[model samples]
Target chain A: MTIAEQVGAPRIVPGRGIPYPCGDPNLPPAAERQWRRQLVQRALDAVAVAVEHPTIFEVDDVNA
Target chain B: MRIVHYVNQFYAGLGGEDSAGIGARVLKGTVGPGRLLAQLLGAEHDIVATLVCGDDHAASHTTAAPELLKMAQAAGADLLVAGPAFGSGRYGLACARLAAVAQAAGLPALAAMHPDNPGISEAGDAPVIAAGATAREMRPSVQRLAAAVTKLAAGEALTAADGRVIQAARVGQLVEQRAAARAVELVLRRLGGDREATEVPVGGFGVVDPAAPVDKAASVTVALVTEGAVVPAGNPDRLESARASRWLRYPVEGADTLASGAWESVDGGFATTAANADPNRLLPLDAARALEREGAIGRLHGEFLTTVGNGTPVATARRFGVEWAAQLRKAGVQAAILTAT
Candidate 1:
């Protein structure tokens, strides 16, 4: 299990799967903005309440 | 050379969540993970021993440090290394605290944590910390840490290590740069005075003679100066976090002294008098009168600069002092004696 998973992380926002782990390298800026916004919203939601155990989801799945 | 390494229970070969409750341990010969580091060094270095403690044990017990020290001494280690603990909050704090203690005791220390970890900044610059995260992913990070340690142990000068970013070594030692010292000396020499302008330090600002020195028969101004302690009762400003605070300037009207036992110091590191009895209440009318009688100052300014001074960051404190002095200049304040109690 990953650390976030092992420690019962409240939320997880997938990066571009690169070592740098920030934004998508190929995506346009507007799409990247949307991705960042979605990720931030997830983080805010998690902190609004106390959570136990890991909760993982796709922040910006281009396919989705 | 002997080296000591610290890690949370999980990374110290204890199992996952279930085993985290394990207490501290001192591995005499070699611990499992120290092998990884020792191998990475490839004869460039050796791992004398490993000092492992559970995260909870380090946090819950403030005495966890002495335990680590005892292990380090027993190991005959010359250097100390704590986890590149990633973003693990408790573990990161433990590593940073232990690293600081070791550094203070005249040992070179290193720690590792992700950039986002709070411990990265809190660790200061004394114990060099390279970037690190999970215990499972220890190859490249351990290699980098070993290289830095190896250089130090070999007495070879090091330019910042591969993963560890340079932070100007902010350990509070103000090393005087030769060029800057010479430049200041040259300037002082240009402005001729009997003073040996090169070595003498600069003094704080004093008020210009505004109304001229008054005769002993006339009223004199006794200014009771303060270092911006104008927070309301209970220090509503909350300006006293031990690490960071800024000063503020406040105005006081004619008052000889604050009423006895009227004000109390909250977050201030300095002592305080009742708001009423305090003579150092900025613009203290009563204190000003007393000063006038004592001929300390000719006149008191209407308003006083207010700012938090308790353990303020050096850069912030310097800026505040400049701004406060500028404000006083604008207000035409004459010479004043700053009082602290």
Candidate 2:
């Protein structure tokens, strides 16, 4: 959301996913950093916003 | 040649939650995912800097977005990239927002995300989202999206993300109904109805009891004029073409000051100045305070809400309003009536 606000970009806030935001603090440094980087990068690419059902942890094909 | 990368606390080398308390920083190049993205680009792109901030800090500061604009301007990055943010909602939303900000500023924005990531749809066409999921997938995703960016930078056309970026069609540009309209007479003929209209214009059908009369001695009615005429005659709010608008809210101040219309226009003809210069900007604050003083309302909300609505997608605009309303509620605001100029 900060990124959106920073760019004065428009975005929809989804209901609670992670307050600290991406990458659980409990993980080891290297793994945690990698996870954090990926999530942040993916977010940078998002041009739209939306919510979801289970909210997190989903599986399936790319086109699905 | 330069690119600015935005990342969450953890990616900025700020430790996780426990360390996430750390401050924000700007770096020279790819730290973690930045490195991967650089590699993915090969020799095609040059990422000059990375700006990392605690998600909380970015989320709380009203001035943060403006601060980011300054940072991007200072960096002079031709391209801006945010996170791919697989499933983290806030981070993902942040990425999408930054992309819009950059795009609004006339820079191409690129980000990656899982197909199911919800922020992609909510952000409303600010970033060029590439396919893939999970951090382990960064290399390829960045590579692909960056390729698209290069193509764009070169003034070359490229195939779209297929369906990755959830794009909204322009208003009045029939989306779901894409087929051309049938002949006017043929369509009107089909719409012709033989039966009389059955519905009433109003919905309230319950009987009304006798109206309670107000005592002349006890009743008082207060009228407040918060004529917040924030306009940039030509609606300069629309900073760019419909697709890439880096919105900059130039204030419309001073109700007494006379101005001429030039930058843009809406249905009304009032001239628009940069939001920072407009005298009408004071109208809301002035009115809110006066209303509060008169006991018409308990308190005035701090800082009038502002945004450049030109070329803004309906979904994102609605989201912004809802989010703003929620925040106002937390601050004890119960109701608000917005007047758009």
Candidate 3:
């Protein structure tokens, strides 16, 4: 994320971690897929929104 | 010290631009500027051999450096000096390539060229003495090369004061004061209106105008891209485990999800156990397919581009991004989801 900020990626969507960026294996299979879906949805939404600078599109902010 | 000098056809007195296609060959002793360099080094160094190749040939032939270095090593040359190439792009590139090859072979090597030569980037960690833009500055350039050669042969570090081009690699050096003291002093100086008193200068990434928001998301084709190093089971393209120099694309057409046994993450920076257990964790192809089916996006671009980003240089990454963006644009991709690890 710091690298993303430093490089000034115009649309940035924060991911989970270095190991599994999208899906959380700890979650139940169905819930995990739903979580992954929301993450992808957030990324999609990020591309649809215009920003003046490197802006972080938080996954949890999807509902907010 | 025994030296092997490299020069292009023009410098070798072979011919002008007409001789540009001449191949690599060796002459027993000093040729052209090598004579001046020899005189500069005085009685201590011997110009054992001169390796001459046409600029066109050197730029095009991959085998030239190794073949020439072999002859140099056979001649028992201890140091390799290539070019006061000045502003000749191809010659400078050849010189830089030779320096890289010589250094890799455990030979002390140095090159002299104009600082703006495109070859400087390919010189690796080899010492490059800054030269002027043309042959008119040959005398000083060779003199600088001679001094640099003496230092390198004696296992001494060349400093910026020696007119060495600033190499891309950051080298650690011991300073008079500790880092904390230096930091505090810099802060105090800045607070006192010395705005330029920075220990390290930061270069900007340059401003990039943001692409306009997708007017109709559901009508656009979105592509998946990753620096996560996801590839087929055996990594058929042999994608590097780290510091990848290239990127490869794989077709995800008609695939609903990436199967664990069929795909894996080869990135060396992180533990791949989780990603290997579920390849989609790195690529999220399954989620993308679901979105496509749901009409959340008009289409998922048929292929996903992958490359290992672990320890990759920013310049290399930028190049990959530029090339991938071009390819995506050509494929009619409206937007992309780039997953980084």
Candidate 4:
């Protein structure tokens, strides 16, 4: 559970942390870029759907 | 261009929490993050002075705005850039207060602070570039604010699309449609037992508890306000096509009515031809005047506030109401009739 879950944020895009929540710093730079892009895209898509209740999106692929 | 920078004690390379009580002081050149803003501003703009003040001192009632503005003027500054104050509540308030003072002194200022900061809500009409919750987002915040400052110096209208400045509210682009046509369609759909969308959110079920009913409608002064962007034909103030931050007050002091061609609608979201040809359509002052003549109301406020309702966010709408209501209250207008398009 994320802070969004803890606080019951009406909407949440799960990639979170103090730093590098979505992408691991130890990962190869190229892989990190891919990981961050997909995470951001999910956040964008999540904004389009209006939700009265808390919802968290999981981004795996760019199109996901 | 001479640019005056502002920072708190810590960013001024002074002591941290211990230095929170320091009085206002002016440094010769860019300190701390002003260097970064300078790099973004390039060599064309001089980071002429960095005015430092303690967060507590700046936030408290000690009064330093006049002197700080005098310092900026003495430096011959063309613009003032204050901190991207992040989530520091006091620091954000300080930057916002300084921004307002600079604007009053004929210098455009830009600052940044997180949306979560209480200062942002109290920032008045001062435009703040969005910042993150901590210094970790400092670079991006500075970059955005510098970009906003550059655009502002060039006298450009920076809207929500610009990605730099954050308006109090954020509204998305909407397709144009007549209210009558949409309403008919919604009615038909609902009759067919299908869910229908609404033009305005009526979560309160389109029901509003009326204000304590005026005891004597004929005795109260009433004010007219509109979000229809109706104004004198020249469009002098150049309010944004969207995401507007300010409103214009058109004095209706003696005029009994608005004549066609004397006023026009500049709202970008809707068809303005009709509203322009007949300004009273968006702002029903003519009708109100008739009501006043019929002894329905005692007086009509001299001036009315007008702003663009097109694509305005709820927060920004609330902001406009707060400011406009204060002005109306000060004028002793006991009642108001607000219209929106």
CA lDDT, every model vs. true structure: 0.54, 0.47, 0.85, 0.69
Candidate closest to the true structure, highest DockQ: 3
iRMSD per model?
29.5, 23.1, 1.3, 22.2
Each candidate's B-chain TM-score, in sequence, is 0.49, 0.48, 0.54, 0.50
User: Which regions of candidate 1 deviate over 4 angstroms?
Assistant: A1-64, B122-125, B168-341
Candidate 4, which CAPRI tier?
A: incorrect
lDDT, model 2: 0.47
Error of 4 at A56 (Å): 30
After best superposition, candidate 4 residue B86: deviation in angstroms? 0.8
Cα error of candidate 2 at position B150, Å: 2.4
Best by TM-score: 3
TM-score to native of every candidate shown:
0.44, 0.42, 0.55, 0.44
Per-candidate DockQ versus the true complex? 0.01, 0.01, 0.54, 0.01
Candidate 1 local lDDT, B1-341, one digit each (tens): 77788877777677764554456787755566567777876775667777888765565455776678767877777888887677565677668767777777777777777654544544544445465556556776677777777776787655564466455433554556777777776787777664554544533322221223224212332223444354445556565534344554444556454443443344345434323233223323443445444554445565544554455554444434333443443344433333222
The TM-score obtained for chain B of candidate 4 when compared with the true chain B: 0.50
Q: Model 1's lDDT to the true fold?
A: 0.54
Candidate 4 residue-wise lDDT, B1-341, digit = tens: 88999999899999886677677889998899999999998977889999988776676532766677778788888888878889776787778878877876678776788765545665545577787879998898888878887888888976665454564355777768777888898998888887646666532111112334355557777787777787888888886757777788888877866777888778888666656655765665665665667776678788888898777765556545545644565567766655555
Strongest candidate by lDDT = 3
- The parts of candidate 2 lying over 4 Å away from their true place are A1-64, B19-24, B115-118, B121-125, B157-159, B162-164, B168-341
Query: Could you give me the TM-score of model 4 versus the true structure?
Result: 0.44
Chain A vs. true chain A, TM-score per model, equals 0.61, 0.41, 0.78, 0.74
